[model samples]
Structure formats: C-alpha cells, structure tokens
Target chain A: MLRSESEAELAFRREVRGWFERELPAELRDLTFRPLPDMVMPWYRKLSRQGWIAPHWPRAFGGMDASPVEQVILMEEAARIGAPEIPTQGLNQIGPILQRFGSDAQKEFHLPRILNGDAIWCQGYSEPGAGSDLASLRTAGSVEGDDVVVTGHKIWTTWGHHADWMYALVRTNKDVPKREGISFILIDMKSSGVLRRPIRTLADEFEFCEVFLDKVRVPRANIVGELNRGWTVATALLSQERLILGSPGNALRAYERLRRLARALGTRLSDSDKLMIAKARIELETLIASFLDAAEGFRDGRPVDSSYLKILSTETTQFILDAAQTVSGAYAGVKFPMDVDGTTIDFSELFLQSRRLSIYGGSNEIQRDLIARNVLAMPRGRA
Target chain B: MSEIAGDQMLISDNVRRLFDASRALPRARAAAACWPDTDRTVLREFIEMGWLSLLLPEDDGGMGASAIDFVALIESLGDLLLPEPVGPMLATVSLLAACQSPAADRLLKAALGDERIVLAATEADRSLQGDTNHIVFDAHWADVVVFATGETEQFSLRAVAKIDVDGLDALVRNIDGGSLCSVRLDGSMGEELASGARARDIFMRCRNMQRLAAAASLLGLVRKSLQDAIDYVKLRRQFGVAVGSFQALQHRAATLHVACQSARALLYEAARTVGTANEAVACAAAKVKAADTAMAVVKESVQFHGAIGFSDEADVALFFRRAVALTAAYGTAEACHRTCFAG
Candidate 1:
C-alpha cells in the first residue's frame, strides 16, 4: 500500500529484478523447499558477485551497504521473481555479529568468504533442552590447551550438513545462571569428531540437520564475546533474527503457492475454497504492511515491537500454507507435483515445511509470552 | 506509512484539545446513555468545525479534503468516544456532492451549512422492518434519510420522521449513545436520486465511506483502549510493584499496540484506495483488519483491567462496548471476509 519507494531504492529494485531475470538459472528460478547446495549456492554466489549478496553489510565488508528500504526492495524483488532466499548464516547471522564482536583477524578471515559463498555458515544455538529456553543450553565447551573442546548435540541446524563453519553458543561454566557461563564461538565444521546427521521433515526436506560434537576442538581465538556471556550475543542477535523471521517472505511464498494451487484446482475448487484462497491473499497483504512497518522501525533504530511481527508473520504464513492445502484438497496428499487441469502445483512438501516457521525463530507461543512480559509489562505469572 | 499531512495534523490537534477540554471520558459516558442517536449540539459543533464539509469538493463550498484527512477527523471522534453520527452525515454529503441534481445539491450545501442532518443506510441487509421501514443509523435526528433498494438497484430518500426508536448497542452509537431508529422507506416516502448504473456508483461510494469511517473509528478506539490499558497497568500495582513491570502483561499489551498500529496503517492504505471498483477488495481487507484488531484491543483492555473492566463504571468498558458495536457497523466482519475471499 505504501507506494513509491525512494528513487534509489526503486532503482535498486530494478537492478535486482534485472539481475534475477537475466542471470538466475532457469531450473533454479525457484529452487524452493530443500534445494541441494549445488542448485542454489552457485547462483547465490553469482548474486554475491553482483554485490547483491548481503545488502545489510557495510560496503567495506563487500556489501552494498543498502539502506533498510533498499534491503526490503531486494528481498521483495527477489521474492516477486520467484528467486529462492540465499542461505544466511554468514550474511545474516554471524556476519553482523562478527563485525560487532569478532577480532579484526576473524572478520577479515570470514567476511569475504561469506560474501563470495566460499563458506556457508550454519548456526549452532539450540540443543535438546535449549530450543526455547536457550539459556539452559548444555552444549559444553571445556578448556583444552589452545582450544576449547566442544561436546553436545545441536538440533534444527539448517543446512548443517552442507555448512563449512558453525557459529555456536557453548556452555563454558555450569555454576552460574544460565545466561552467564556461555560463550559464542565459531568452529570449522570439518574439525575432527564433528558429525552432522540430516533430519527429514514432514515435507521430506533434508534442509535441517542434527550436529554432534564429540569433543571437537575449536581454537580459543574463535570465541566472539566474553567466555561466559553468549547470551549477550544472543540478545544482540534477536533484533536481526526477528527482522528476518518477521519478514513477509514466508507468508508471501505461501500465498504464491496457494495462488498456483487454486489455479490448478480450477473447477475442482468450490466457492468456499476460492474464498479461503482470497483470505490468504488478504492475510498476506496485512503481513506485508506489518513487516514494512517493522523494517522502518529497525531502520530508525526504534525500539522494535518484534514479537508481534514474529507471531503475525509466522502464523499468517501457516494460515496461507493451510489454505494451500485446502485449495489442493485431496491433491494435497499426493507425492509429486502434477498438472491439475492446466496448472502444475504441489502442496504437501511446502505446506509441511512451512509449519517449521512458527516452531522455529522462537515459537509464536513463546513470542506471545515475550510480548506480554517485555512489551506489555504484564505481571509474570509464576508456575 | 507516510506521515499525516500538516493540515491534517493541525485538525487532529484541534480535536485533541477539544477532547482535553471536554473531559472526553465523562462526555463519552453521558453520550452513551442516549446511544447511536446524537445531540444536535454535538453535530453542530462538528459541522461548525467544517468536519461535515471536509470531504466535499471545494466547489461544493467545502474543504476538498482527502479521504485520509477525513480518517484523521473520524478517528479523533472515535478516540473521544463521542456518540455523534458523523459517518452517515459525511457519507450523505460526500455522495450528494458527486451526484448531478439541483435539489440534492441544495440539500448537500445546506448540510455543509449544518442546517440539515442526513442519515444514509448503515446496515447490510436490505429487508425492511415491519413491511414499511427498517432502523437506519442516526435516523432519530436525521433531516433526511436515504437508502438503496438492493433488489431494484435504485436510490431513495425520505424526510426524517423523528420517531421513537431504541438502539440495540450492536450497530450504532459506538462513541456517543443514542437510539438508532427504523425509518419507513416504502410507500413512496422520498425522492430517487439515481437508478441503474448511476445508483450503483452512488451506492458504492457511500458504502466505502461508511465502511472506511467505521474502520477509522475503530482505529481510534483501538488506540484509546490500548493506551488506557498501558496507563492502567503502569499505575495498578500487585505484589508491592507496578503490574506493568511484569513481562507477561507487557507482551500482551505490546501485541495489542502492534495490532492497533498495523490496523491504522491499513486504514490509511484503504483510504487511499477507497473509491475504485478495482480497489474494493483492498478496502474490504482494511476494514476487516481494523474491525478484528479493534475488537481484540478492547477485549484485552477489559482483561488487563481485571474486575473493574467488566463493570459499567470503568470507561474502558465503554470503549469496549464501542469497539464491539463498531466492529459490526457499516459491514460486519463476516460481510468483510466475504468481500475479501468470496469472488
């Protein structure tokens, strides 16, 4: 609804749009779901080469130093053209963190590799006990000469099996409160005793993995922040993480899928079915409006009300996905994409994958609690 | 969302000052007793302020204000919970301004002069009450009552009878309470302004205006409800501490705040796109979000206040009542969802 982006932002959108049209591989224009590394990484690096890899990063760090508007334009244009999102451990997660907390050497060594897609990074924050209550993560790191021996399991690591490096929070001291006694560190995924086991999701997607560290040694220099304050980095990272999570991308994608599914269903879809599809579109627009507002807040350095965005964005995406299933009715259970009438659409895989949106990036339920406590100032109910 | 224009800001400031001077909550409580119906003085003050003429073209001896500016004014009225029927009056004048008629033009000009109050259709269903007339919002004080016959696709207007009617607290008087009355639209009671396609255009214009105003009103109530809750939580203490300091309530309140703000943005967006058939879907979406968010905020506002919120004494209850009534005003959520999803 907010029209007319700044001339430069509009120009940036045009540039990104042209690049996607001319350079994106036809087979991979939308390598959605769990794309194998090869189908997407090379093209992503091509974007990296065009200086479109990480719009949020500083120009000196091999990025466009794009403003928030420009960044939104990039994502929006990319989504519009059916281009898949680039993996963002290096770009979104560790890149900014490293800039803020990494040593010059660490930044120099890692930032360029990330920019060129020479190294794809994966986060290692959650363990069996630490998904939502991340403070209690027991991914241990004990001191060993010139290194920290890490041992524990980290779950839901996106592209963990394909990652070149892992940035993680490891428990370094057990006696202190959970927030303390944790350190943010980077480790080579190729290190001895490292294991990544891909987990198949409801979508049959192998995009996530369970990574095990059997006393794998990460150099002491890899620690980003203080030895026992990884939570600070975690806290600092929330804004950016929420920014990405709260975006309208997932919702837009689901809406697009629903559109295609509805078309495929053709005469098969009842008026009620079509109505549901339209509802999804309306829901998507609301998410888009909500997202742009949040992004503007981020750009202004305003105290962001992100939990609402998180809850709204993720839940709306789920709603769209649910609608996709309804439109695809009966066909929703089919295994592969098929031409329903003239339109080819698949529902099960993407529908199943979208469920993870709410579950991850902090569950919407937990986000509501955070909103109640941190934003609304409600009394904390004791269990 | 771009900023509200400067003149609009000045107008809103004037309204804020008016509410500050009027002691809005007390005014709101007093207004609620009469419900959906309005005092001529309240309408006169609004007309005197040029609000009634705000959206009419300058050629019509009015402000030629943008829809968004109109939104700003309507929202202010909503925030004050003033039980005046601004929407129906605004819609009648704006619609009249668009039509080609010497007599209607005179009536429109007279309305801008605050001499006449016009009440247009505010309900969705076309069925006439008692085989003659149905309750029209603001009909109690209307100098003119206009309605669209869905079956014939025609427009008709009748002089106000000023009869005794009761508001159900469901469709009208969200801010100031009054009796919403049913008027006799049958028996050749009034004049036909337009028919066929022309009538449809007029209907669409008035429908969008009514819905947009309802949404804007809800936006105002949403902000007031959330603000009141925030203030209450900050002051109300438990366990020897400010309850607002607690994380749980903070998040809940934040959710409402976010919802309200987003709905506000949607309201403005809807305003910008209101009149075209191409943007009808967009307009419906905005009203739907506003209605849903406004209801959520008021309901939560009541909860956040605990026992007192459920009582008639708390002004938040009035705000809650207004939110509920406004949700179904113009078009109910079901109607809006149909507009959104149903082809």
Candidate 2:
C-alpha cells in the first residue's frame, strides 16, 4: 500500500486481493502482458458491475461513494498485481466532468454508459499544433442548425481508435482570443467524416491515434459547460488529471519488476548496483507519502500539489528502469524476455515505455511552468 | 500553518523584529562579514530575550524546549541570513540536553546561560580510530565541542583548538565566515556521554535536527530569493515589457515554490516523528529535495535578477552564497540520498 492502512483499509485490501485472486483470471493478471480492450474490458465491467468503477463518484451516479482511502487501495491493489489498466479516459476525467458540468440530460445519458462500460471515451484535447498550449487548439466547430460541424485533427489521442466517442475542444469562434474561441463538444467516433489513424508508440503498441474530424456533426446538447467557455470546463479537472497521471502505482509496478528481475538474474552485483536499487526504492516510498497527500487533497477539496508528484513519479520510475536496463546487461535490446529458468522479463518495453511518462500529462517542463506560475504566484516572463 | 503554537508564533514574531532591527545592509556591505560571527547588539538581544535557552529542557531548569516548539524561530533566523552560529549552537545544546553526563549538564546550562559555548562539531571520518575532526563547525566558538568520535562509539565533550577556515562559499558565507576552525582533540580527554549504539542513536537525532533546521533555513533563503527575483523580473524590463510578465520565468519560479513546499512538508513531518522510521526517510528526502531546490532557485535567481545579480551588491547574491554553503553543510543531496537509500 502507498500509505499506512487502518484495520478497515487492511480488511478491504484482503477482500480486494481475494476477489482479484478468484475473479481476475490468472491469464489476465500477467505482468509481462499489456491488456488491450477485449482482455481488459470484462474486468473493468466486473468492477463497474460492483459499482466500484468510479471510486470518487457520488452514489447517486453509480459510484459506491468509496472514500479516498478506498479509491487509493483499489488503485494500489490493481496496480500491485499488474491487472490491466482500465480505459481511464471515462473513469477518471469525462465521467467526473459530466457529473460536474453536464446538463441533467447529458449526465443521464453519458454517466451511466461510462460506469457500465457501455461507452468508451478518448480525449481530443492535444493536437499537433496544440499540445502544451491546448487552449490554442484550432479545431473548429461551426454551428449548423442543432448540430455543431467540427473539422480538425487531434493527435496524441490515447485509445482514440478504441473509443466510441470523444469529448474535445474545438474553436467555435475564430475572431475571439485563442482560448475564448474554444468549445467542449462530444463527438461520436463513428460519425460521418470521422477517421482514426493509430499511432504505434516506442513500446511498439498501438495505444494512441490521430483522431481526424472533418465536418463531423455533433448534437448541440453535447457541448459541455457553455460554448466558448470550454477552457474553464475542460480545465476543471486539471488537478484530477495531474493526480491520476502522477500516481506512484506505475513506479511501484516498475520497482517490483526491477526487484523481481534482480532476484532472478542471480548475478553477483557490486555495492553500487544495490545502492541504486535502494535509491529508487527509497524514492518510490517517499513519493507515496506525497501521492497519498495529493489524493486526499483532491478528494477533500484541499489545494493539491500534484505537479511535484508528476515529476517524482516519472523521474523515479525512470531511475528504476535505468537500473533494470543495466541489470538486463547484454539483453537490454531484446524485444522479448530472455528466459533464465522459467522467469520471463521484458525490461525493453519497460525502459521504452517509461520515456513517455514525462512527455505525456503535459510535459514535465509545462508542469514546472504550471507550478511556478499558478502555485508559486511568480511573475510571468514576457508573453 | 495551524501547527504553529501561539507561543511559537510570538517567538517568531519577536525574532523577526530583532532581525529587522539589526538590518544587515550596512553590515552585509562589509562583503567579508558572514555567519558564525554575530552583530553584538542582536546577539545581546537574543541573550536578553531567553532565546538561548530554547534547546535546554525544563528539567534542566530551562523552558524544556525543542526545535518543534520554536521551529518558526529557527526558520525566521534563516530568512534574515542571521550572522550567528545560532543553528548549530542550539543543536549542540539539544544534544547535550539528551546526553546523560554531569559534564553535559554543566555544559548545557552554561551554554544556555551564554557563559560557556558548546558548539557542535563534525564527526571524525568513519575510518579514523583515534580522535581527529578537521571540519568542526564553529569549533573556535566553543569552550567545549560536542563530538561523535570513532564511528559513533564515543560521544565526547572535548576542549578544542581553533583552526582558520580554508575554503569558503561565494554571500553571507557559512556560519559567520570567520571563527570556523578545525580542531585537534586528544582522544583521551573529555567526558564520554554515550558509547556504541546509544551514541549513534543520539547522533542520528542531533544530525537529523541539524539537517531539518538547515533545510528549513535554506527553504527560507529560497523563498526570499524567489521573491527578490519576482520583484526584479517585474521592475527590470527586457525589450518592451517586464520580464516578469513572461510565462517561461513564471513557471520556473512556480516549480521552485513546489520544491520549497514539498521540502517543508517533509521537514515538519520528519520533525514531528524524530525517532520513528518515517523520520529517517523523511529527513533524507527533505534534505535532498530542499538542498537541490535551494541550489536551483539561487542559481536561476541570479539569471532572473540579471546583470545586477552578478555583482556583489545584490543581496540576493548573499542568499545564493548562503544557499551554496547550507546545501553542503548539513548534507549534500548525494549524501542525503545515500542515507535515504542505505538507511
């Protein structure tokens, strides 16, 4: 666990572990495997069926209303076993956004679908021209009757090909400033003129895509918050997004892999090698404290300081991955795990995949800027 | 913020008042005048205000105090870049207060009375068998230096000889830049407070307290430097607009604040649980993070403050120097990381 658990938390952990042992098929819990939709969704739906999908959601909206501790425990246990990562676009962001800003009709339509795993969502925020400067998005959505005709390209859309729909920022007014012209519109991926070209990442997985929208008409009711004010609505979940993206679970998984591999290798290592591993472990443990604080901060509506967590998680994971690669020695470039006796370990992907940790979730540089300006209230430089 | 005791707040306010009254501008103007040395008047005021007795326990006839009671006071002392060996002095006092020795009692009481000084000393390198510590802090100021000898086996209060400071950091130099002396000790002399494991235990507590205060102080220096940079970036224009208006600089400054806050949270958390497993990890983490932050913020602040920042006249440079010295004093990031990992 990332934090110390109360008796109840400990009991909950056991329950989760037991349920996972029974319900989470051993085949699905493979640490070496990445869970794609078919292999992943059933488990997600199981959690959803139990009303445990949205831990932070209110009971009124399909959530069990699990406390922050419970939510964190769920993440820790799931990540602990390398249970497939659920499609979090709906679970973490859109569901919460819709819950907060969605019209009653919108919430009634989408929130249930999201909880039930009947609908999958991808973010349409980052485009080739507008990654860190997301508000400068040029994707235009023009009003035509009761439909908004959106035409633009969105890149870095994680799971865009797998998603059934997307909630995106499109410029609804060109004459206004870059940010003010934007509107948050939900578009069906199967709509006319919608196209998805999958992007293969460094880890050799097609987990992301470029979502192409050409005159795709979305219903007017799908506009979240208000038109031209999508910036506010979209950014409403920035803290939540940061907290999720900055979690220590991923690092913990990586660290566990490193330790496991070290033990299996049976290689006699020098003191420094052991020290580096120790350093990463210490950092991972220290980061969990901050992570727990951030989680509670988000849940309790306290000022969450998650930018540091983002930096810490990524850097520490990379540190561990670096050690793993070193321990892998001559086999660092191998695509598949080289077998010793029976232990299979593919640190190549771990090393490659860890690279994007800092690049995504708004590059570490951008997070630093956010920390410097928003949190510190330091003066901005010349625009 | 709520953790501040009412008395602590008053103590901090009083310390700030005293520091401001002894404004170091004319003094800092002297260039070479730095820490471990004090402004006589300010030192006298601290003496009169009973600030000297803060580390002594009431059982020893003082306020039964600890850094937790007056951590704010320590932090504010850091903010002003006070030119006294107050930090190590207080830490040394606390060390003696915890040690069970008749000499410790007399030494601590005299230290509190401002009669005889008991400055903390650096440990002899782990390999050395006999007594030899060439890098003791404020060794020249102490009537008797409290030192850990021979890899934590011996906690000794020894009479010391002051050797002049050799290498120095570039504003407010480390602990009154003057009066820092290397000392030689006859291993046979001084009172043995504790030996072996018990000695190491006290050493950890004292070392951690020193580290916690040093990191907190560096954070204060960073906060002040960041503010100074903020002020400069606003007033000092580059091209047609104020440089402070640039998002690039703002973000960097914001990141420093994050580091400061993170370090602070860890510092206080570690402080609260001094003898726990959490304290060891927290102390090392806080030290590493805070030290790195202080360095980054200070160096970048020079650039943010521009041409003037490079000159000796810029008070921010003083902060930069103090940061450089402080970062290495209690422990460097590398050392702290080692402690964190190897603990």
Candidate 3:
C-alpha cells in the first residue's frame, strides 16, 4: 500500500485476487501444514497452466516473468485465499540455478518439466555431517568415465520421499579446500541405490525425509557448473533464497489464525492476552512492510542482504503462533486439532511446526553472523 | 515523476537543508533547560516555510499539501531532533481549521502567520479532580488552546487564552523536556466554535493526525539512534576488536535495524492512506509499531555504546528520552490497539 502502484499493477492484483478466490479448492484453503504431493500436485499444475507458477523466472523460459510488485501481489493473493503450500525446491532453487549456470541441454530438459509439475524436486544440500558448516561435506562423487558415482546421506530433504529428483551438493574432489571441492549435481530418485525414509517431526508428520544415495550413478553432464565450483554456484543465489524465505506468506497465515483465536475468545480475553495479540498485530504488519521494502530492493539490483528480513519473517510468524497458542486455553496443549466455535484450532501443531522456521534456512544465529560480517563489515574475531 | 511528486521531493529537500543549516539539535541541547521556549528561530523558520498549514485545504487559504508530503517534513524534523514543537503546532492548527468558525479562523490565521503558539488539548490526556483539571501537552509555549467539550459525537470545540484558564499550574517538563501543565476549564468557559458532528469529526481527525505525526517522529528517532550506535560500535573497541564484531551485540543491532526499517515502511504506507477507508486500522498499526520499535531500538542503542551512552553528553541519550515521550504522545501503543479493535 505504500507504493503508488500503476493501473496495471492494480488490475493485476484484482485479477489474481479474484482467480484465487474462485479457483482454489475449499479443502486446500488455510491448511496449517503442507499437504502431501499426492493431494497438492493438481493445484500446482493448475497454477502452472495459468502461467503464474514461475513468477520470478524469465519469459524466455516457460514463465510469466512478472515484475517484483506483481510477484508480491501474486503471493499476497495466494495467501489471502489460504492456498496450500506447494513444493518450491524446483521453482525457487534448482530451476533458477539451472537458468543461471546450467547448459542449454540441461535447461531444455528440466525447465519445462519444473513448470508443468512433471518433475517434483527436492534439495539435497544438508548431509548428516554438513549443515551450517555445509562446505565441510564428505559426501563423495567420483567420476567414472561418463558418469558420477555418488554416495551420501542427505538429511532434512523436504518431500524427498515423493520427489522424482534431487539437486545435491557432493564432494567432487577432496584435495582442494572444503568450499572449493564441492559440485552441484542432479540425481534421479529412481536410481538403483537411491532410497528415502520419511522422518517424523515433533508434530507427528512426514514433512521431511532422509535421502540415502549408495553408489548412485548419475550422468556427469548433470552437474550444474564446473566441478568443484558448487559453492559459488549455490551462493550466487544466497540473497535470493533469503528473499524467498523472508516472504510474508507464512506470517500472514499465522496472523489469520491469531485473528481467529482472538475473535473466538471475544470479551472473555484478558487484558494481558489482548496486549499480546496487539503485539503480534504490530509485528505481522511490520513484517509485511519490511517484505515489500526488501522486495523492491531486490528488483532494483540493490544487493540487498535479506538476512534481517529472514529473521524478522520467521520470528514474527512464530510470535503470532505463540499468541495463538496462548489464547487456546485448555486447547493450547492438545496434540490434535480441536473445534473452537466452528473454527478448527490447531494451536499445538502450528506452534510446534514453526520452530523449524528459525532453525532451517541457515538458522537465525547464522543469519545474524552474516549480517554482522557482510552487511556491517564487522571484523572477524576468534570467539 | 509527476509534478506533484517532484514538488513534494523539493519540499522535503528544502526542509532537510533548512534543518542542516539551523543546526537545530545542537541548539536544542544547548538550551535544554529552557524546555518549550527554546529554539524559537527554527520554529519561525518552519512556519515561514509554510509547513504549519501544509495539511489544510487550499479553500482554507493554505497550500493544501497532502499528508504524504506533510509526513516527510515531520520525519525530517524528528530525525534532526528539533525542539521546536513544529509537529504539534502543525497538527493542532490543522485541527483548528476544521472548526470553520470566525474564532477558529482567527486563531488559525494568526498561528499560520507565526504570530502565536497554539496546541490541542486531547481527550487521551490525564484529568485531575474528576475531569476539571486537564493536562495539556506543549502548554508552556501556548498562548491559546483549542479543546473539545461534551461527549462522543456531540462534542464541540472551545478556544481559550492561557490567561483565561483558572488554576493554571507551573509548567511540568516531560521526559523529553517538553512542557505540560494542568489547567481548570469549566464546561461553559471558552468561545465555542462548532458543535455536534462537525466538532466530532474535527477532534477525530486531529487525534488521528497527532498519532501519525508522533509515529513518524518516533521512526526518525529510532533511525538516528540505531545509525549512531552502529557508527559508534565500529569505532568503540573492546577485547582488541570493535565491539560490533561480537555476535551478541551484532545480533541485537541487526534485529533493531530490521525493526527500524519495518517501522519506517509502515509509517509511509499509513501516511498514504490518511483519508481512505482503511485509515483507522492503518494509522493505528503504524503508530503502535513505530512506538514499540522506537523504544526497542533506542534502548538497545544506548546499551551498545557502553557507559558513555548512559550520560547526557551522548546524543543517543536524547533520542532515548524522546522515544519515551513520543511513544505516549497521542496514545500509548496499548491505547491505539484498543481503539483499532474497538471500531
């Protein structure tokens, strides 16, 4: 709302808003957790067919090439109608990486598949031993003439069990420095030795899976960039990743829950509870404003380090969920969803699930360090 | 850019230049003891710049600048920590113009001409002796006051000279060193301007504008404090490294920086919708967020500077005090939230 949008932007927003309200299925609306691929792919393909699936992708590919404001408007309208969360590993990470660093053959094969939901993708960056210190990965991939034999245990591969492929970071050479020896490659989940086991979360759902690759053979041409250049290839989009993660979508959903909780409680709400709800209101509103500002910065090629936005978005979402949990009263600790005045309140599920927001995507602490070292130019200290 | 946008930009640039040339912050610091009476020259410059009537319509003999342009000027005045009460003066006069009476017009014209200082007495202020003695903000510099009487939508505006008010107490300095006083006003006292719905609309608009202006000022204070602290931490050394290099402080600073950024965005957004259907909700959100963010950032900024930040000599200390005062100015964050939901 801060922007004096052109008539074109306004019209775009209205069109998008109306479409989501009309076309989104009632079952998919306002889901507290991500639905499994089997239930959500049809909706994903619907968005793809509408040319709105890859708003950030270039028009040269099968994408809408929407402007930054248009992209934000798309996200807002989607969240407004409570559109179910869709898998974005291909749309956000692998597809963009391929466009930037992939060969024409690689692009030609995978780009359209991603746009049409024909290939479900998952990121395989975090091996069991390589998380925040991701460069220290020991997952080996050795060249065998025309192929690369890969063996690695990738943990926290979101939707990996259902994904058709994984874009992985493997150690192509152990002789060079940790960051220098890594390679970004794609592996077929259907390969002989590739196995995925779903990991049950605290919320008792299989939102993530552990993917194991035992001598899995993939073509050497599947590598996204020059071997041992994976670190830079992946990092070229670090700021962009932060921008996508820092979006107000999740926070808005949590706020919708908070409003519902507040409305259900009504005059029964205590002053202290009301105050907490008010704080959440302020935080959510600010999160939205902050996202818009950061998005504009991203569009203008302003080198905006969105580490702070990431922290704000996740923490604000968690804060709103906290308020929701607080007002739940006797329903606060219920493991399952309960009906509260006709609204299904999944207080515990949403609240517990949000803990991953801060921990995933380079943990908030790592984000802080990035801001300190990169943005503030603070000197590195031994501690 | 459109002509109006270009003009607004020019107006903002001129205001920034005027504040730079006046050296208003140093002057305010030097005359700290004078409270509301200090920095008359800068205040006169603001009036001469035609900002006091910026929000009034051209039909009322004003420049009729939009609230968006007006907010830009107030944000600058805030960032510079000018002690002139220009924001309060402008907000109060703009409300006075809504009365559309001979008495209101006389007061408005006189104030706009830089002839006198006028301030609004809001309902949010504390009343002593069961509503007889009303506490008014910026009363030390005021020659006249425009206050509302009656209840709800039936309210009417009344104007009174400070000399005409009974039981006028000594000026009480606020946390930021602004002047306030308790004055007794019987129901029938000052010259009545407008009654019923018209007066209610005036009072309502005046309150909303005050909240917004205060929020903008808070944002300015937060920005200055956070930036000064960031600069200070880069220079201040401890344990053989700049203090900012440490993760504990760095994380806190980064969080506050984001808070400041978001608060600024909300303020500008809310300013854009000043007269729209979403005005109440947007304005309340902006005010509350700005006030909360200002307190968080300014307080942490003081800590980031070590012992020096706690002393009066440090500039951040001033921002800290101003943040405290402004957060409670139009309405407390809690009050704004209540009003937002009450509707």
List each candidate's DockQ score: 0.36, 0.28, 0.44
Best by TM-score: 3
Point out where model 3 deviates above 4 Å.
A1-22, A58-60, A64-81, B1-26, B35-39, B57-64, B97-101, B126-135, B151-153, B167-169, B182-187, B192-195
**Residue-by-residue lDDT tens digits, candidate 3, B83-170:** 6666777778888787878988888889988888888775645554445566677677787887877776657778888788864446
Error of 3 at B263 (Å): 1.3
Q: Please state the i-RMS of candidate 2.
A: 3.7
RMSD of each: 4.6, 4.7, 3.2
Residue A271 miss distance in model 3 (angstroms): 2.6
Clashing pairs in 3: none
Worst 10 residues of 1 chain B by lDDT: B161-170
Q: Write the per-residue lDDT of candidate 2 for residues A1-383, one digit (tens) a residue.
A: 32346789889889988887778887776445457778888988998876678877788888877776686677677766767667888978888888888999999999889998889999999999998888888899899999999999999988999999898999999998887888988888899999999998988888789988899989999999888999898777676677777676677778777776767766575556666676666566556656665666666677777677777778778978888887777778888766665766766877888888888877888888777666656566444
Please give me the DockQ of candidate 1 compared with the native complex: 0.36
- Candidate 3 docks with a DockQ of 0.44
Among the numbered candidates, top DockQ falls to 3
> Model 1 segments beyond 4 Å from truth?
A1-23, A29-32, A55-60, A64-81, A142-147, A173-176, A225-229, B1-10, B16-36, B56-65, B96-105, B122-136, B145-206, B226-258, B272-278, B300-310
| Candidate number with the higher DockQ (2 or 3) | 3
How good is model 3 by TM-score? Answer: 0.91
Per residue, candidate 1 scores C-alpha lDDT tens digits across A103-200 of 89899999989999899899898888788888889989998888999999999999899999999999999998878899998989999999989998
- How high is the TM-score of chain A in each model? 0.93, 0.94, 0.94
B-chain TM-score of model 1 = 0.86
lDDT of 2 at A145: 96
Q: What class would a CAPRI assessor give candidate 1's docking?
A: acceptable
